[model samples]
Target: MSFATPSLIDAARSVLIVVDIQERLCPVMTDPRGVLFNGARLVRGARRLGVPVVVTEQYPKGLGPTMHDILSELGDGASSAVIEKTHFSAAAEPLVRQHLESLGRRQAVICGIEAHVCVTQTAIDLRAAGWEVFVVSDACSSRRPESLTAALTRFPAAGVVPVITEMVLFEWLADKNNDGFKDIMSLVR
Candidate 1:
């Protein structure tokens, strides 16, 4: 089947998935500074739109905790949930799936470390399971930029839509005159 060009994210129906942005993983990412900054801004914009947020830590026991930057922005509330998993794809973890179900979210705007592994797998699986998946290219990283490049190259074939942070925010806002338009535009700009 052919896929249509992805429309803007519907904040009311969308969620943001931050995958494996743990302390140890972040430091080793290809461009930690850029990844972390964009990831943080994504969280901020997602929060402002009142979209549900979920995070996954890959084997937190050995790798380390989710970095403070992400956690600080997500906070602790009904709007966000964090899960720990040994699986690269968060959707494969029972808790993560349950949390997503709890939010009743069908579309996931995803970002994080290790693009070819966790992020890619999650995008593929989530799409296979019938959720719309959008991979936030700029907010995801790996030890080699090649990995991110590869995922961006391959995921769309598996039904994962690749997007940048600004595209996501604007889609979620949809119009400059909407109530949240200015706030999301400020974040995007």
Candidate 2:
């Protein structure tokens, strides 16, 4: 098993992926409030840095669309793309890969639901496809905390770095001298 060392500062070349946080899933996820808030903050921060954000709905027919709060935060922004997927691994979806390639983003910080299922598969597939994948553990949840725990345990060897939301944000900003630093710091706090 190979492990990946993620450089949090390389966020300029990274995208933010929110996976399968659909309406039905979110309500049952362990710690839904925290996950939703963190995902939103991460998306907002990604936008502030001009990083692209990609979201996937895991079969909207059954799960319903991505949660309204998350959808609102993305807000039809050009940098944000929503892909509807039937596959567990979003990387396997053509448009998801196409959008990543189009942005020239080779690294991503991934957050969302069912950490042991869709998130895990997407992380592995994304890495196999030659992208550096960082799974933001704090911003991700499953219906059971144990599932999230299992993913955090196993994903490193598959080349996904399990990280916290604030770590990614600060590393991306690098220093407080920049204008966006204060705004990001506020969000982190």
Candidate 3:
């Protein structure tokens, strides 16, 4: 029997999407600190590797802005863009779709809050829209643990790949010889 090799995320073809890890929503999540830590790692690693980042804020006026910690990791915002969205699925937002398209990438690494709602919907829609979707499992959460469990269960059938923060950082690095290797390693260490 022959098996095809699964694809790894190529830094050049990938974009990191931070979804609704906002001020008002975060403290209520199942593991807010873990999510924030790993999400920040993803953001910093993506920046160091030159991967474009897109951050989504769901009803920022109500939820408040993306948490300060995540925002701080974005590093001067030159390589990242934030879209304020009312839609549960960020892919359904015109501006979000347009921004992702403009990045010229087909692989998306996604993380953030309300896993069963915004995160899951966005992952499924992005997958259907022809982007290879990797949902960062450790960097996503819900107010309830069951909801987060449900979202992880739904991913396989919806064609979303579940991944962790370190998997993404090392994959983006691709080799120990890569220039960003030590910087990426430090995030996980």
Candidate 4:
């Protein structure tokens, strides 16, 4: 995947990874509502597109659980694997690696909290592990805007693509005539 150009994120070869959108962490983020709303929407879109999802909660005991809205969107853990971890990067966890290997997908669409920490590290690590990473900017936040900016600035340099929620949805669809177009389009709008 060329960091200088747009890489095709084929749904057939993609997985949606949402990192640390936990209950306690949500309120402290710079764009709490935007992050959660877009993150939840991304989950719905991923399900609609038949893309596997891996959601991680960083120390759920301290962070509280994954937020209600996101958990509800993810459902009763029916389709997505919800992993718990202490590592800043979910990619560093054994379970996350297992999911990635089992899914056998090359592209990862990432959304979550604390852009400068867990989310950024996971994206970088995933890229290093030979996965094409796309970090959804609107769905990521930090307590300070500067931190988000700093991480985003390093994304392309690290070969991780920084994108938005809608881009992932549309790119995964890659066509309007497909069956889930309206459903995915509604989530983006």
Weakest 10 consecutive residues of candidate 4 by summed lDDT: 1-10
Candidate 1: where is the Cα deviation over 4 Å?
1-5
Model 3 gets an lDDT of 0.92
Q: What's the TM for model 2?
A: 0.95
Q: Compared with the true structure, what per-residue lDDT tens digits does model 3 show for residues 47-145?
A: 999999999999999999999899999977677998999999999999999999988899989999899999999999988877789999999999999
How much lDDT does each candidate structure score? 0.88, 0.87, 0.92, 0.88
Please state every model's RMSD to the true fold in angstroms.
Answer: 1.5, 1.4, 2.7, 1.8
Top lDDT model: 3
**TM-scores, in order shown?**
0.94, 0.95, 0.96, 0.95
- Tens-place lDDT digits, model 1, residues 1-189: 555555568999999999989888899888888778888889888888899899899999898998888898987667988889988889899999988988887899999989999999999888888888899898999999888899999986898889888888888888888888888877866
Tens-place lDDT digits, model 2, residues 97-178: 8887899878978999989999999999989877888899989999998999999999867778898989888877878796
In candidate 4, what are the lDDT values of residues 1-189, reduced to their tens digit?
454454788889999999999889999999999998999898988888788889898998999888987888876545588999888988999988887789878888999989999999999998887888999999999999999999999998888899998888888899979899999978866
Screening candidate 2 with a backbone cut-off below 3 angstroms (N, C-alpha, C), the clashing residue pairs are none
